[model samples]
Target: MKYVDEFRDRDKAAILVREIGALAACIGRQIHIMEVCGGHTHSIFRYGVEGMLPSRIELVHGPGCPVCVLPIGRVDACLGIAEQPGVIFTTFGDAMRVPGSRKSLMQAKAEGADIRMVYSPLDALAIARANPEREVVFFGLGFETTMPSTALTILQADREDIANFSVFCNHITIVPTIRAILESPDLELDGFLGPGHVSMVIGTAPYEFIARFHRKPMVIAGFEPLDILQSIWMVLKQIKDGRAEIENQYARVVPEAGNAAALRAVAQVYELREFFEWRGLGSIEHSGVQLRAEYARFDAERKFAIPNISIADPAACQCGEVLKGLIKPWQCRLFGSACTPETPLGALMVSSEGACAAYHQYGGKVQRAETA
Candidate 1:
């Protein structure tokens, strides 16, 4: 609570807000700063950060939710693997609700598939340990923050000679996705609130491209309200000074060089795929990772005969444009009326970290006030 209580201090928040307001006035025009993590998106909405900022400042949501960006094809693939006769499919609880082409994992489980919710890949490994005859496949997903645990789990599986355990790797890299967003012809981003958890593992070095090549200021930000306010102030300062560089506002957790052990584990277990499909963003080169040949024995793709196929997103869902900051979640016609969390029509409404779900759950009143 030492880190958390201090970050949530009201006096510190007020000071940061005042400083941010002054910076906003100095800019004197619209400035869009993206928080490239779904956790940040949820925090922003939950803390009413959108309402706190000046009208000229817009906090655009990025495609940082691993579950939101996971393509329907991949979900279908996961479902395919889950439905196998002898397999026990394990995945994070959030992923159970994500709809594939036809149904969700939860739905599949309700219909008699051997689906399970696991907190970690190690939990899936434990399941494999308990069930020797049943094949246990863990659905892997997320950025660098979660990749180390999966890598270490695979290593553990190998060490114990857990022949029945495997992983369905859907892990993605943040840098390439950010690059894709920056390269978009319609982009109007002035700066970025970098992903803190991912930065903790990969370090600040990978984000240099945003500053050096794309000429955008980036601050690796923590998930606290005051931390967000301070990060926004930092980005504004960079823009005012006409400097573009990567800064770490969450220095307490994220180091400049990152964690060497995590990086080594990731490098040992996984290799970047040439291209991977995102639900909204399409296929971006080198955006996803897969198990290395050395770990092929524990690779779920090799272990299961899944229906490897692509499934297009629902035509009515504007998740792609929403992800690109072209529109807010409410702007989509299907937002609250058709795509409530109870029955998500888009990927964004399904996950707690998702922008649509965040706005729906916490930012609805703020959004209404803005419209009024």
Candidate 2:
């Protein structure tokens, strides 16, 4: 609670909010500040940070949730491997609810597939070790934050000679996806609140393009309310001074160069894909990772012959637009009515890290208070 309580202090938050309001007043016109991480989105809504901001300043949620961005085709491929005889499919719980073209992994589990919800890739390895005969497939999903651990697990599996254990690699890079967002013509974002967790691994250097090329300021931010507040102030301060630059507010965890040993593990086990399909963002070049050639024995794609076909997102679900910050979650017709969390029609509704889900659970209460 030491770090947390200090960040959450109401008195400090009030002072920061007043400073941010003054800064926003100087900007004078409507400014769209995008928080390119789901954790920041969650913090904003949870702590009423959005409500505290000046009316002219808007916080747009970007495509940062890895599970939210995971394409349906990938889910279908996972189902194919999961349904295979004598195969054990293991994945994070959030991924099980993501709807494929036909059915979700949850549906497959109900219909008798050996599907297990695992917290980590190492858990899947343990399952493989316990059952030497059955093939254990770990459905890897996330950004750079989780990649090194999964990569390390694969290395461990290779060293231990766990013949039955393999990973269905779906790990994505944040920078490419951010580049994709910046390239979109419809998006008129002024600044960004960068992801702290991903920066902790990949570091601040990768985000220089946001300021250098795109001419938008970015503050690498932590998940805490005060961290987010200070980050907003930093971005607004950049705008006030007409300076576009990348700054780090969460430097306590994220280094300027990032973790060297973690990078080594990732380099050893994985390589960049030519292009990877995102659920909302479509295919972005070099945005995904796959098992390296040396680790071919632990590659799930090679181990199982999967039907790798693209499945289009639902017509009613405006997840793509929502992800791009074109509209709020409630603006989508299917959001609360057809796409409730209990019966989610889009990937964003299924994942807690998703902007839509965060907005639904946390946004409304604060919004109403502010509006009132």
Candidate 3:
């Protein structure tokens, strides 16, 4: 608990596993728990936490990977902006590989588009400042965790009067996505392992709806192996006690009230869109944010002629089903063959945090063959 190694302690993990098993046995039915964060999905596979769980508990992967959840139309739109003459398109490296309708940003770069990967939005702003003559657009994406930084960076651009810089804001919200999943007709989730990173920004307050309305318990969890196992035990405890509540196991990093300054910056720079499309989850009302009209000068959508068209995935891709937790990554026929990380055909395989990418890297080979 004190250090990284402490959170990965095998002994402590074993104890929590046993406790989880004991509690899981009391439920007398299958316990389908969803880890509503892509980071948690990657950690579960990387640390082999899924194998450590009891047979009764199933940890379903959710649409928590912000990069993986962006719909194809959005990528196509980014591609259009990137290909424009004299425009410098900057985005996180993982996003370069997300398949656009015609080609990914990586492919576009190879074909002479000035697509550069930067660590943060500020880096894009710096590129804009350094090259006053060229248009610099940062392809901003992610949940609440990455929004504040982008917002602050945009504010800086405004203060500095960087007219050449703009943001292609594809930032989405978490609460609406979670609510959409819960509202799905066939969703079978028993409880949830909430995202730790997003919780640090938005806090545990928003998740009270899950417990209060849906009557499902959710524990905001950290990414370490022990943190995951302990959270699993915490969720199992609620099930055995017939309780529904939102608990924060990541309280050491995530304050219940959230980051006030970050929230303020985001509020000042952006406003909720009427609706936004997700790769697998489709359109969820107010699930994404856009630049406020006051910041319209720095909004890429308003600045550039983007082809904002909704696109369906490849005919063979089952990423939508996998994202909905209706199918495992390996269950998709294209998993390791046509859809390997090197030549990804869907959003899930484009990012490290995505469930399909995690499965292909850590496990699911034998199952993949069965489906293949």
Candidate 4:
């Protein structure tokens, strides 16, 4: 409780709030700062961080939720893998709720597909080891934070000579995605709250371009209330001083150099794809990772005959606009009325880390205020 209690203190939070307000007054214009991680977005909504800030400051939610950004077509591909006879499909709990063109993985499970909810790839490996005869496929997806474990799991499978195990790798990189956002003409971000977990794995060095070339300050932020508040203050301070630099506010957890062993493991197993599709953002160059040629034996896409089709999102769902910070979650026409956590019309409504889900769950006051 030491770090938790210390970070949540009202006195410290108020001091940071006062400092941020004082800095905002000097700038005397609207400031848009994007938080590039879904966890930070969740914290902002849960702690009512937006209400505490000056009205001039708008916290734009970027496409950081891996589950939220997973395209309908890819989910369909995952279902294609899941529906195959003798195949056991394993995925994270949030992924089960993501709607495909036809049905969700959860719906598939209900209809007798061997779909499983696993905490890690190792669990899927364990299932593969247990079954021996049936094919076990782990649905791998996310930014660099979760890649090392999946890579190491593949290494473990190789060591044990597990013939029935493979990974449906949808692993993506964060740098190119951020670069894409920065290049978009519609968004005019003043700074960024960089992803904490991904930065821990890949380090703060990769983000230098955000500050150096883009001229936008970025503070690698943590998920706690105080951590977010302080990070906001850091970004504001940088803007006040006309300094654009990458600073790590989550230094206790993330290092400037990153975890070398984790990077090594990730490099050992995966290589960048030429271009990969995202739900709303579309195809980004070098944005996704696939199992290297050497690890093709453990690659599910290679092992299975998949119908890698590209399906469009629903007509009413404005997830693409929301992801680009062009619109807020509540502004989406299908929000709350047609799309709820129980029945998600869009990927954003399915995951708790998603902007729509966080807003739906905790933005009651914000919704009423905005709608009024």
Candidate 5:
């Protein structure tokens, strides 16, 4: 309660709001600050942070949710792997519900495919150890924060001589994707709310380019309301003082250098792919990780033969524009009405950390006020 209660003081929150309002008025321009973490998006909405801010300050959501950015083709590929003889597919719970071209992994599970929801790659490796005769594939997906854990599991499997264990790597980096968003002609961002968890892996050095080249202020924030508010204040202060730099609001958790051992583990097991497909962002160069040549035997794609197919998203979903900060979640015609989380028309709705789902669950009041 020491750290938690202190950051949530109502009086402190009100004072911060007043200060932010003053700063917003001083800027005199429509300042668009995008929060690149899905957790930050959820926190902002859940705490009504957007409603408390000045109207001039706009918070755009970025492609930070791993489950949301996973391409439909990748889901289909996982299904293909799951259906193979003597194969058991494992992944995080979120991936199970994300729809592929025709069916979700959950649907595949119901149809008798060996699809297990695992919390970590280690759990999948344990399964592989238990069933030595059957092939086990861990469907890995996330940004830098989760990659080290996956990398460690692969190393553990190799060390223990677990021949049946393989990895279907869909791990991506945050920096390259952020560069893509910043360089896009349609987006007009003034600053960035950098991802906290991803920063804990790659450190703050990678994000210096956003400030140095693009002159965009960035504040890496935690998931709490006060942490987000303090980060907003940091961004506003930088803008007010005409300084562009990277500031870490979640200093208690994230350091400037980050965890070196975890980074080394990821470097040991994976190499950057030339191009990787995202659900909405298409193929981003050097944005994803694949098993290195040394680890090819443990690569699921290499171990199995499957047809390559590219499928388009639903015609009505505007998830592409939404992810890129070109439009808001509510701007998508299918949002809430035709595409609720229970029956998502797009990946954005299915992911818990997705901008659309956050808006649907917590920003409905703000949406009504805007319409009124």
Candidate 6:
């Protein structure tokens, strides 16, 4: 309760809001601040922060949810691996629900594909140890926070000489994607609420580019109401003062240098791919990681000749726009009508941190009325 209660104090929150309001009046322009963490998106919606803010201060969602940004082709590739003879697929719970071209991993499991939900990569390794006869493929997907754990698991597997365990790496970097977003001609963001979890791994230095080059103010914040409010206030203050910089609001957990051991572990097993496709951003150069040549034996893609096929997204699904901050979730015609969490039209609906699902769960009625 020490950190939790202190950050959420109503008085502090009110002060931040008052400051933000004053800052907004001075700026006198539509200040678009995008929060690049899906966790932040959920927190923002859950706390009704959007409604509390000045109308001119808009918070746009970015490609923070790894599960949400996983291209449809990649999902299909996982499904294909799951269907292989004597193969057991392991992935985090979020991936189990994200729809592929035609079927989800959950549906595939229901239809007897031997897909197992794992809390961590170590859990998948344990499953592989238990079933020596079957090949265990850990479908790895996440940004920096989870990648270190997966990298460690791979190292452990190699040390144990686990022949059957392999990884399908889809680990993405946060900095490059942020650079891509800023470089894009379409997105006109005033500032960014950087990902706190990612900052814990890569540190605040990676985000200095946003401030130095793009001249956008950014605050790496934790996933709490007051943490978010304080971050919003920091961004507003920067804008008001006609200054741009990267600030760390969640300093208790994130150091400027970040977790060196975790980053070293990532470097040990993986190397950046030339390009990897994202749901919204398409193929951004060196945004994804693949197992290094030394660890090639543990790489699932190398172990199995899985066809890399490119599939088109549903013509009507506006997930691309949602990820790029071009449109809100409710702006998509399929949002509540055709794409609820129960029957998600795209990955955004399936992921808990996904902007569409967060908006639907927390701001559906309010969004509907406003849109109507």
Q: Over 4 Å off in model 6, which ranges?
A: none
Q: Residue-wise lDDT of candidate 6 within 6-106, one digit each (tens)?
A: 86677888888898998999988988899999899988987788888888888888889998889889999999899998999999988888888889999
Q: Is candidate 4 or 6 superior in lDDT?
A: 4
Per-residue C-alpha lDDT of model 1 across residues 208-271, encoded as one tens digit per residue: 8889999999999999998899999999999999999999999999999999999999999999
For each candidate, the alpha-carbon lDDT, in order, equals 0.91, 0.89, 0.90, 0.91, 0.88, 0.89
Model 1 scores worst on lDDT over the 10 consecutive residues at 363-372
lDDT of 5 by residue, 121-206 (tens): 99999999999999999999999989999999989888898999999988998888999988888978888888999988888999
lDDT of 5: 0.88
Candidate 3 ranges with C-alpha deviation above 4 Å: 366-372
Q: Write the per-residue lDDT of candidate 2 for residues 1-372, one digit (tens) a residue.
A: 877899898999899989988998888999999998888887887888887888888888888888888888998899999999999999989888887878899999999999999998999999999999999999999999899999999999999999999999999999998998999999878999999999999888999999999999999999999999999999999999999998999999999899999999999899999999988778899999999899999999987866568877787788878877788777778877888778778867878778778877877445535545
Report the poorest 10 consecutive residues by lDDT, candidate 4: 363-372
TM-score of each: 0.97, 0.96, 0.96, 0.97, 0.96, 0.96
Model 1 residue 95 distance off true place after TM-score fit, in angstroms: 0.6
Q: What's the lDDT for candidate 4?
A: 0.91
Model 3, residue 97: distance off in Å is 0.6
Name the weakest run of 10 consecutive residues (lDDT summed) in model 3: 363-372
